[model samples]
Target chain A: MKTWTIKLIVGGCFILALVVTVTSFFCNDDFWKVNAAQALTLILTICIAFWATQLKNDVRKKKEHAEQILKKIQAIVNNDGFYYVSAESDAIETQKRMTMTFRSLNNSIDLLKKYGQELGFKVNAEYIEKEFKDYRDFVSEHITDVDYLSRSESTLRKHSENIDNKCDIIIWGLY
Target chain B: MIVINISKDFTDTPGARYKSEGEYSGELFRETILIPKYVEAIASKSQLKVELDGGYGYATSFLEESFGGLAREYDIQEVLRTLVFESNDEPGLINEITEYIKMARRERK
Candidate 1:
């Protein structure tokens, strides 16, 4: 339940307890009436306490899940930077690795989008999806282009810029 | 019809390990040789034929990344209509390639 609703319930219960005490003091002071009022107050307090505890546990779980997803997003960024730098070197082996990296990068970005959507980051998910599609189209086009190995460096950089732009929002908004 | 022999023109050994079929290992073959050659043939409106028997063997990855990738970029039926198979040495190779193209289309859908 909302914080306001919780406060309202607890406050209302305290007021009822105070009213019962004042009425008993002013009236015939029936012992049973006082006892009934006390019992009702105690039950409401206990129920409120239980609800608050469950809410705390849920918040803690969400925090942990958010932390885990942030760590994964960081790893993806690190790999993107590594691949971008690796692609720029004038080496055949490195060049070959760049294509493989692009494919792997695609899968990572896709997963990030999925996790974001599940976390209710609808806007962020859309951004990731649009950028991912662009990356896929670029790869499909060049996966057959001449000198693709050497030419892919700039493309990798393009992906780096595109993906990094949204990482901030994911980190900031989800938490 | 215009034909390019995979073993003769592109590479004698064509395939990716089944274990890492997603290698994109043979990407070079597809991008640099196979696609350009195939596109050149298709642009001329000439029926393009791929001679598949000369290669050491075919990998599902290589075939899919090439023909399957092509089907994604071009019209599947048009691509298939313009293409033929010269797999006399291995009659099944043509069917496998066709299957890859069909499957790739389904995957995209």
Candidate 2:
């Protein structure tokens, strides 16, 4: 439940307890009024206790979800994410890898948007997007450089690593 | 608008950057599919919309070569103005293509 909703529940209970206690004092016998006030206080205390537990659970779940997204971003940075595949000779395999990578990156952006906005953090997607574009461009530019493939591959790997660092900066800011 | 559905008109399984790389290459797309439609659109004074969804995925080379190569042949500004790209599957693709077109000449030089 939303923080506001929980707060509203607490507020409503407080109002109810105050009205009941005040009315009992004025309208009931001293012994009955005292017992009624005590009972109402106990009920209010239990409600608050439940509300606190629920709030803690909500915070924990949000943290875990953030961590899950962080792990995915880490995988992309490590160049070993499920979608991050080596460029293969087979066009079909290559296409599959590329498609998945694109989708994965896009999904990361979406996840960051949701979590960051909810958590009141700034999300800058430009850096990651540019880094990915650079990596892809490097691969395409040097795909046929057979004589210097190793050097080009290293440069490509560096670009991928750069993406990882950028993610840390952007996504870590959320925390 | 003149619409070119890449997945339908051309091979959905697009390959690498150059023709020498293999079948369904970016060079092939540019020379065969993209350029012809572009020319027709130009002649008709209509904007060409290149739909880039429904494909497995595109290599950077394929994307760069196809759109960037077009910019190389025509004025980059004209190419940018005349062509519109739609990639619902990958929203970033439009920006990537735009960058490729913008940098085509510098890279070529």
TM-score, one value per model: 0.43, 0.63
Question: Worst lDDT window (10 residues) for model 1 chain B?
Answer: B15-24
Candidate 1 C-alpha lDDT tens digits along B1-109: 7877878877655534222433334566667776786788778988888887654454445666778887887888888888888865545457667887787778785
Number of the top candidate by lDDT?
A: 2
Name the regions of candidate 1 deviating beyond 4 angstroms: A1-48, A78-111, A140-147, B1-109
Q: What would the per-residue lDDT of candidate 1 be over residues A50-69, giving only the tens digit for each residue? A: 99999888866765665565
Q: Per-residue lDDT tens digits of candidate 2, residues B1-109? A: 9999999998777777888877788899999989999999999999999998897767778888899999989889889999998988877779879999999879765
lDDT of 1: 0.62
Each model's lDDT comes to 0.62, 0.73
TM-score of chain A of each: 0.53, 0.54
For A9-65, candidate 2 gives per-residue lDDT tens digits of 999999998999899878877735347789999899999999999998887688568
